[model samples]
Target: MCTVCGCGTSHDHDHGHDHAHGHSHGELHFGHGPAGAQVAGMSQARLIEIETDILSKNDRFAAANRQVLQARGAFAVNLVSSPGSGKTTLLCKTIEALGDQPLAVIEGDQQTANDAERIRATGAQAVQINTGKGCHLDAHMVGHAMEHLDIAPGSVLFIENVGNLVCPAGFDLGEDCKVAVLSVTEGEDKPLKYPDMFTVSKLALLNKTDLAPHCDVDLDLYEANLRRVNPGIEVLRLSARTGEGMREWIAWLRGNLGRKVPQAAE
Candidate 1:
């Protein structure tokens, strides 16, 4: 039987039907024949085609979202981090630092609106996308949230991706840059182990620096390893819990924003 579709017949043969009987009678071979083989093959091809079509559609939607954001002169940042890496906390601090600036956030998670609630507490317009069973947020989901968000022209939009270091790196969310967050407690060798995540990120946020004294992570060595993989990538070491080293992080963000809008300060 086909376990996937449950449409094919069982291939079990009766022990009672001896081999001697099968020589003359074809009842022993009681499974789908040539016609069924052809049907199964066609079904598999159709499935492959469907998967290809779905990914292509998603890529198109992502490109469209990028164009829309560029036309509006908005900068979108996609935040990727592991669970409990303080991604939401950093976002709250970012919103606070930007004070009175036009900023919106899209929070992605497998369940619960907890992160979105946190962002809202910081006074930023936030939309939560519960991906259900999806491991990562795709561009389609982000685009849908954009419709509900009151994003102004030239505003900053931060997308807090589902807390994951692996799967999220493979998907593009039409963001201007990707920020990868890694806490000191997670170990210094993470960049070497998960090279793809480090490679794709424009900036690496090394969170929980206040706990560096307690952990055995070598900050200098970690930064060296990261630069080896991604030369010229900006790394910010900060602790959201203690608010240490946040100024540098915020300054870098503001500088990037300034480059986009020269009259931003005025």
Candidate 2:
């Protein structure tokens, strides 16, 4: 079990070959301990220790990934959101807008290559990772994906993490920043309800705003709550389908990417 988020650690990678990664994924049985009695069998201190160890190891891997990207002058952003937030649509639109910009994508999901295929349809290089029971993608998994993903020098890389609001917030997958994609339909209190995700995000994209009028949601309240958690987070309200506010989103991407890969942004 992944003590960081209590999610399953087993993975069903998209790659064909088998290689060993130094992950501390041990088989954790919840019931039927000593004397045929059901028990959790672990103390709070032990749990904390395990969590620390896991995060520490993950940080090491993240640092290595960061170094490689830096050496290649590649800018990476980790886009995270809950399911059905229109993230894929926004990503596809962004790819379309960029046109000839050197870009690659790392798509993460628990099953199927559907999203990766969508990205490929846009003519951008993409690698899909299927994490069978894993709730989030760790640095180790991303580092492996990078091996197969031909990230170009002075290009932008987008890592679309597993559609999870909680687990993905804690794991740093060597991205330059984390962008939280929240649909206006998801409710205004989402930032308050999931503060960790908002707090960790550098930017929050309020997507599908074209439906805000239909949903009777308060856009101001959403922004207010997002600021209550992450005062420094930049928010962009956009509709991927209608092309509304996409220019600003594209500008933000260029500005951020320029910090690392100036030619790609240009």
Candidate 3:
């Protein structure tokens, strides 16, 4: 099974040769030596072709979802981070900062709806998608949930992707931008370790600055690593718990939403 996408099938194979080798059915067979050895090279090639097809299909769906969101004038933001990285807390702060503006949240988790409940407490419309054992939320799931939301045409929709750095980066949730959340407690080298997450993200939120005084996290090193992977990516240092640097975060969000909503027609 593939650990990244959680989409792989286990199969038993029989090798007619002295050396044990496994091959999937419908694969090419290369005749081995003068001993009539059965070649199973085609099976491996088939597997690669199937994997490519699956990813291409998924990419198509993601593009369609993006079009739908854009047509509705929705500013969708995908939040990604490790578990306990304070995604919900930052979302709550964002909701509060939006004030009377129309905002909706789509919370993704492995099991419980606890994060969605917390988001709803902030008076924003919140929907939770429990992915069960799945590590990431794909475009289809987000597109489906969008229909059930009460978001207005020009609303801001925040999709808090499952708390994971790897799989989520591989799956696009049809969002206008992906915002990666890395708490100070998670250390500064996270960007270096998870280069794909940082590279694809349009913005990086370095949360828990309030605890910086107590933790050994080096802010400079963290920012340096993120820049190394994506020099153009915006980085924000904030503490959701203490509300530090929240205004700037809110301002950034408002600016994005404002651009999408358009100015008053004279």
- Go through the candidates in order and give each one's C-alpha lDDT: 0.77, 0.84, 0.79
Which is the leading candidate under lDDT? 2
lDDT of 2 at 215: 99
Query: lDDT ranking from best to worst?
Result: 2, 3, 1
lDDT per residue (tens digit) for residues 4-110 in model 3 = 21254343344433334447885543333332232243244344444465567667878987877677777889999999999998888888878898878999998
Best of the two (1, 2) by lDDT: 2
Candidate numbers sorted by TM-score from highest down? 2, 3, 1
Following a full C-alpha superposition, what root-mean-square deviation does model 2 have from the true structure?
A: 9.7
Model 1 residue runs over 4 Å out of place are 1-55, 261-266
Q: What would the C-alpha RMSD of candidate 3 be, to one decimal place?
A: 8.1
Best by TM-score: 2
Q: Of 2 and 3, which scores higher on lDDT?
A: 2
Indicate the residue-level lDDT of 72 in model 1: 67
Error of 3 at 85 (Å): 0.5
Q: How many backbone clashes does candidate 2 have?
A: 0
Q: 155-204, model 2: which lDDT tens digit per residue? A: 78999999999878878889899999999999999999889899999999
Candidate 3 — which residues are off by over 4 angstroms? Answer: 1-50, 263-266
